[model samples]
Target: MSPNVNRLRVIALYKELHRLGRDYPDRSYDFNGRMRRMFEKNRHLTDPEDIEKAIQFGEYIKSETLALYSLKKYRALKRMYPSDDKH
Candidate 1:
């Protein structure tokens, strides 16, 4: 991908992740703050491969965040309605 395209993808991913961070599983962890710092640290890359790798890593983080949220909901449901087999 061209450098311009990579920049756009990174910006889009950053924005989406920041938005998703509002519903992050742990509010005490400063998810958005940490994400901003990490992205700032990696903002100077010029290599296409490195940028691509960073984008992929960002995608991975996004998926993991979603998984954590899903797991949280699952735990809530489990607590709300207990299974009867144990009794």
Candidate 2:
């Protein structure tokens, strides 16, 4: 992939991570800080393969975070409307 495309992907991931962090049940500040630091720490990577791998990893994390958020929301909903069929 072109360098421009790779850079854009990284930027998008960073923005998405920050946006998702806002709704994190844990400390948003800490989550955002860790996300920022993870990217910053890897900012120096020059190898195309390594950069691709990192981007893939970021995507995986994003998916996992979304799943976790969904599960949390589901649990909250269940608590609010618990089933009457308690056995």
Candidate 3:
């Protein structure tokens, strides 16, 4: 994907995460946990940075397409729930 597309994809994930975090104030832990699970489960759906190597060497490894489940997303989630200790 293009840089712009990747950026937009990240932004969309950010927005979705933001909305999820905002929607369930009391169940934030559950929400975040679910998100984390989803991340872990789909950690291998696409090869973001190694497309060429994957194709050339036939070493294709399915990686999670959702970059939002990354560390950056965790940071953002922490920022959103500053007072939450569910982590």
Candidate 4:
């Protein structure tokens, strides 16, 4: 992929991560700080292969975070309106 495309993808991932951090169940600041540190740690990477790997890892993290949040929401909903079978 082109350098421009890679940069854009990185930026998009950064924004998405930060947006999701807002809804983190606890330690929002800690999460955000860790996210920023992860990016910063890779800021100097010049190898295309390494950068691509980082991007893929970031994407994976985003998906996992989404799934976890979804599960949490589902659990909350269940608690609020448990199934009749349980009763």
Q: Scored by CA lDDT, what does every candidate get? A: 0.91, 0.92, 0.49, 0.92
Q: Candidate 1's residue-wise lDDT over 1-87, tens digit each? A: 888899889999999999989988777999999999989999998888888888999999999988888899999999999689976
Candidate 3 residue runs with Cα over 4 Å from true position = 25-29, 47-87
Structural similarity to truth (TM-score) of each candidate: 0.91, 0.92, 0.33, 0.90
TM-score of candidate 4 against the unseen true structure: 0.90
CA deviation > 4 Å runs, candidate 2: none
Q: Tens digit of lDDT per residue, candidate 2, span 2-74? A: 8899999999999998899999888845888898889999999999999999999999989999998999999
The alpha-carbon deviation from the true structure for residue 71 of candidate 2, after best TM-score superposition, in angstroms, is: 0.6
Superposition error at 56 for model 3 (Å)? 29
Instruction: Sort all candidates by TM-score, best to worst.
Output: 2, 1, 4, 3
- Candidate 1 off by > 4 Å: none
RMSD (CA, Å), each prediction: 1.4, 1.6, 15.3, 1.8
> Cα deviation in Å at residue 74, candidate 3?
31
Superior candidate under lDDT, 2 versus 3: 2
Q: Write the per-residue lDDT of candidate 3 for residues 1-87, one digit (tens) a residue.
A: 775675565445645654555544455367656655654554454666753333322211112323334655688888897695678
